[model samples]
Target: MDLQIIQNRIIEIRGQRVMLDFHLAELYEVETKVLKQAVRRNIERFPEDFMFELTKSELDKLRSQTVTFDWKPTTYAPFVFTEQGVAMLSSVLKSKKAIRVNVEIIRAFVQLRKLAIQNSEIIHRIDEMEKKYDKQFKEVFTALRYLIHPPEKERRRIGYKK
Candidate 1:
């Protein structure tokens, strides 16, 4: 029900962001097996672009790296649902919670994209400012160095410490 919980389920897999089947099932308040079965029944709805099973290596890497789940290394690898796949899932899931959660997940993704774009723009502007000030900063430092240490001809002791 909480959007924040659903948003954190988004993860990067196979060079694209996706949601794992178990996380989706949890969000939908369904068992993982039920979710997988529903997807199987509506296989045509989910094309390769929409959903794909994780390769053994990929699954292994996820299991080893993630602290989130205690997934046993089963004979079958987990399925990943892309943005499109998530959208399609609502039709197959056939529950009020699934529908509401799907909508929330979509909104969360859009918000995430907006935040990423805003951050990138801020970083680009800061980089430009750094470049613009680099030469000016170097010149100021050079002038300060000269002021701190004058030529030998201009060097004269004003007073000696006792």
Candidate 2:
């Protein structure tokens, strides 16, 4: 499986990297229901940090940002799996396809981690350089830091705007 394909599916939720169950099922070539059933059967293997259901607000926030996925409000909030949770999935899902997909997914996560570390190092370097320079270059260094790690934008309200 392509690394970018898996990376695109990964999203940040609750300040942690996670993949939605539906996406995992798609990668595993299994129906979402079947995947959920298998997980339910092996609940002991997953812990809170490994996997957790999305809160209503989190689901709504995702739906508001995404247009490609028709995410209607369902009774059960979708479960999101962290990197560790995804690793555990291989044990629950005995199929060869599932195991292969799991490996690819883990690779994608590792690649993303590497990219994050690179950006952090770049940011650290900028900070060090900023301290050495006078006030004239202060703005330049600030801009560079922002470019490397942009701040989160304020989310708009869901109701109709006044």
Candidate 3:
């Protein structure tokens, strides 16, 4: 279980980091349907905050943006499992592979958290420095801000004569 591979499977939905059922099933070495069935059987173990089914519109938006290999061209939307939901899955799955994969998934989530915290710290330090240097480094700070958040694309004028 490579950490990068696991991290790539994790995505943001509704402002929460989550893993899709199909990705979890692949990591757990079980069929998607079987994994979903296990979760359904132990529904009480997973609360709304722990797990939720993707809405049709959300699924459609995801499909349009990325190639979801595991999802079939069917009407059923996928279930998303949060960090807590993924940790709970090990108990429901009751398999050595499931337990091992869950550990790796948890590690990936923790790594992401650490990276986010470090990023915020860096941004805070940059802000403090900018305040200390005031107008002296205004252009430099502006460039840094642009690097942090680039502007969105602008449409070109239509039917330009010259």
Give the winner by TM-score: 3
Any idea what lDDT model 3 has? Answer: 0.91
Cand. 1 Cα-lDDT: 0.83
lDDT of every predicted structure (CA atoms) = 0.83, 0.90, 0.91
- The alpha-carbon lDDT assigned to residue 115 of candidate 1 equals 79
Off by over 4 Å in 1: 136-162
Question: Which is better, 1 or 3, measured by lDDT?
Answer: 3
Rank all candidate structures by their lDDT, best first, as comma-separated numbers. Answer: 3, 2, 1
Candidate 1 residue 157 Cα shift, in angstroms, is: 60
Q: What residue runs in model 2 are displaced by over 4 Å at the alpha carbon?
A: 70-73, 150-162
Candidate RMSDs in order: 15.6, 2.3, 4.1
Q: Highest lDDT among the candidates is held by which one?
A: 3
**Per-residue alpha-carbon lDDT of candidate 1 for residues 1-162, written as tens digits (9 for 90 to 100):** 666777788888977778999888888889888999999999999999899999988987988668777575557788899889999999998889899989999888888789789977866765576578867676765564466455667645568866
Instruction: Tell me the deviation in Å of residue 37 in model 2.
Output: 0.4
Model 3 spans > 4 angstroms off: 68-70, 152-162
Clashes of each: 0, 0, 0
**For model 2, where is the 10-residue window of minimal lDDT?**
66-75
